[model samples]
Structures are given as structure tokens and as C-alpha cells.
Target: MLKGKPKYKAIRILEGCGFHAQMGLEVLEQRSLINTSPNGYLDMHDHIEEMGRNIACRLHPNEPNKRRRLCDKEEIEEVLVNDLGTKATRIMNLKNPSIHPATIIEKLRKMKALELLSVYDADRVSQNWVFDEDVQYFPDTLRSLHWTGYPASSLPKTFQANDLVNLEMTRSCISQLWEDGDRKVE
Candidate 1:
């Protein structure tokens, strides 16, 4: 599970994967593990938050490629630069990435087991970060994705959505998901 409180979409995916987030929330509420913040976000005690981070870090202390999630910019950049991602990485949520979008997509080919990937503006306002080139590939195991300000006119011809359950591209420059090919519809 992720360190911070999961959002609505994440809860839905957790439910799809057989997790009862509502039930867990109830338990947390009963135990005072969380408090409703002024802005409505769940706030966890600092110690609890630290414990969660520690648990995630202890999973594979020496190897980031074995971690299930990569949320840090530097670690993600290092992994991308070194091509160290493995099948163990299931979720990658990047916000305002400084690295080239091309490099990110190019290295994603190695994450064969990636299921949830999001590269969006954290503030939900910036429109500066845009993918200039066509994404040539996406893992066949993807279940959810979010890419804001996608500048390409269409997704890659090689890309397929056979296993995609959720796809959100808000304020993107995309004109179509894919081009009309030399084929017929059923």
C-alpha cells in the first residue's frame, strides 16, 4: 500500500484488487490513526507516517528496482538514468518531473509489471510539462494511468489498452487516442 492516504481513484483500484479501504479506514478511525484535516485530507500522526516510510524503505533498502513504488524524484531519475527498473515496480507516480519525458517513456519498457502509472501536475494547474513525442510503448499489465498535458496528437500505434481499466488525460493536447488504421470495426 502507499504511504499517504489513498485518493478516490486509488481506493477504487484497491477495491478492484480486493482491498476494503472503507473497512480499514473505519479501523483507523477507531484507533485514532488518522484525523480529518481542515482541508479534508486525512492526516496521520507523524510517528505513523514515519513508520510507514520506514516499512517501505526496509523492503529493499539497497535496491530501488525491487521496491513496489517509487515516489521520489531523485530516486526515480536515478532509476531511469541507470535503467534499473524491474518487474517488481507496480506503481510510479511522478509530479512535475524534471527529467525529459522521452527518457521516462523510453525507460518504461523495462517495467513489465507496472500497473498504476501517473505523470501529472501535482497542483492540477500547471500546463508547462507536456509530452512532445509519441509514447512508443506501455506495459501490457497496466490497470490505471494519468498523464496531464499530453501534447501528442495521438498515442503510439503500438500501444494497446487491452488491460487498461482507467485512463485520465486532463488538459491534454491529444486530438485522438489512436489513428484510424487500415482495419474494420465489428
Candidate 2:
């Protein structure tokens, strides 16, 4: 843990050792001690919305925070839209078991900069759901998609994002990733 005032010299020294102290001295000074461990340290410049999304994505049912009632969807959306100007690129764990899948889909469709989407159903089983809209509604910049309990029988015909690198769907009804037989898989 870093204690005391983190002056410019201290910041530089930490940086020289491959540690980042980008939060600046004023912010660091407010904390009595800063833990530099991997899980303890977080970039101050990182959007809280993004961080919350990640937390929700990685949240385990048995985690202590879950019992404390940490899920607050409205607050997360507010920070994502108001504070970060809706600039989130990676979205994960936005689905909570209690919330309906349709609502989650609607929320995802509106994210302008969303590049990575990871969703899980808390029910532990696949539910039949369909996205009736064209795949073009999804951001072309999307690179990774992980959806648990996906309800569709096949991937959207309009899904042609060239930037996509990872796709995972568990407990899904998908029979094929695309309709075009001519498309090559590399």
C-alpha cells in the first residue's frame, strides 16, 4: 500500500518501476493508503460505468457483494450515459436474473459505442427469446460477444461485423453462425 503524499517524485519513481500513478497527487493524498495490488488498484480515469458493468459481469451468485444488494441498474445507466457520455466500448454482465431479457436487449441496442457484449441469465437455463430487428442495429465495431442462454435458433442474418474476434453462446438454440453458405471461415 502506498501511504503518505504521492508527490511528483514518488509518482515518477512508481512509474519507473512499471507501476502507474496516474490519479495524480491530489487524489492520492485524499486516501490514507492506496493498495497497489492488482485487484486493489484501479485507474481513476476509468469510467465508473464501465467498471460497474465489469463487476456485474463477473459477479458470482455467492459473492458477498451480491448479498449486500449491490446491483443498481438505474444508477449504472446514469453514469454510463451522463458521466461517460455513452462512450462505453465493452459491455458485460448487464443482465440480472430478476430483469426480463427483453429489457436487457432493449438497453443493449441503445449503447452507441458498445464493442463487447457479455450477458448471462441468472435462471441457469435457456429461455426462448428473439431479436426481431435487423442485425445492423448492433454496432459494427463489436469485437466480442458472450451470451449465456441465448434463445435464437441462428445468428442474425445481418450480423456481418468484420471486427468480431470472439463469440460464445452457451445453452443456445443456434444451428449455424451465418446463413450464407459462400462465406469462408478463417
Candidate 3:
């Protein structure tokens, strides 16, 4: 592991990812690191939470507390500055995920982390938002946005244009938006 604290550059990245140095023990370890240990999963959660907090703060600066709350099966997408094109800043949106691994893969392909935008699934999709695609390795700052108990695919897709503001959509509605290619800024 790292001796003492992480380097300045690393800290900057961590800060940008919404992680302070204090919450470094809650990260989830990948299967490779999970040799019958408890810290691994905790660490994973921390790291995922940090990423989610950062994304939420960036996307919705006005309400940091509301966005960073912990839970299960949360969903969000973050586009880097270089990828924004006309948009000056990056964009991040939280969304849920499918339970089945096959469905997860399908959703990942459709989300197009390599093409449309990058996607990270922490703790089975919605445990937290992470910059790393490898869900196996988790960092510190465990704070999951996932609170819903249902699977992403099970939720209904009913979020229509001009409906997001008025609608507190369930996982299904959000998934439907992505499935139908209907993120029209409602």
C-alpha cells in the first residue's frame, strides 16, 4: 500500500473525485484482493462513494448534501471536459442498473463508455459512482448513492420530456430514458 498519505497529484485527483484523506478505509477490494477480508469491501464502498459525491457535486453544485447521500443501486454518468465539445464543463447523471450480469454488459455496451460516455458501476451498479471501470478494485471514501431496493431493469421507463423536474422517477423510468434514447432535458 501507499506509505503515509497519497502524493499531491493523487490527492488532487481524489479531491476532484470527492474524496477526502480521512475516509480511506471503506473501499471495496476486487476479487483478487478479497482473500477472506472485511476491509476490502468497506474500502470499495468508500472509493465508490467518493466518486459519486464528486460527480453529484459537479453536476448539481447547488445541493451537495442531497446528491451525496448513501444508498444502493444508484445511477450516474460523467463526461470529461475534453469530451464536452461545445459544453464548457463535464456532465454527470446518476442512474440505476440491471441485476443480471448479462444485462449489465448489454447496458454497458449501450451506454458506450468507450463511445458515448464513460460508465462506472460500484457495488453491483448504483452502490456508488466510480471513475474506474474495473468494479473489482475499490478505493477509500465509501458512500453509496444507491438506496432503491429494486433492480434497474425492473423499474419503468416513463420519464418524458419536461417531466424530469416534476417527476421523481424510479430506476425503471430512468432506464427507459436510456433504453429509448430519450434524455431530452426534461
Q: Against the unseen true structure, what C-alpha lDDT does each candidate score?
A: 0.70, 0.49, 0.29
User: Which scores higher on lDDT, 2 or 3?
Assistant: 2
Ranking by TM-score: 1, 2, 3
Model 1 worst lDDT run, 10 consecutive residues:
177-186
* Number of the candidate with higher TM-score, 2 or 3: 2
User: Model 2 has how many clashing residue pairs?
Assistant: 0
RMSD of 1: 4.3
For model 2, residues 1-186, the per-residue Cα lDDT tens digits are 122223443464445434565665445536733334354332333364455445654644333222212234554344333333243433433454455554454444445555556566657455666656553245555565667776666655545556665566888766677645435234
- Per-candidate clashes come to 0, 0, 27
Model 2 misplaced stretches (Cα beyond 4 Å): 1-89, 95-97, 134-136, 179-186
Tens digits of per-residue lDDT for model 3, 20-113 = 7334432322332212233321122456556655665675464322333212233322221112212222222333333433333233322221
Instruction: Write the number of the candidate with greater lDDT, choosing between 1 and 3.
Output: 1
Return the clash pairs for model 1, or none. Answer: none
Stretches > 4 Å off in candidate 1: 1-8, 34-50, 121-135, 181-186
Candidate that would win on lDDT: 1
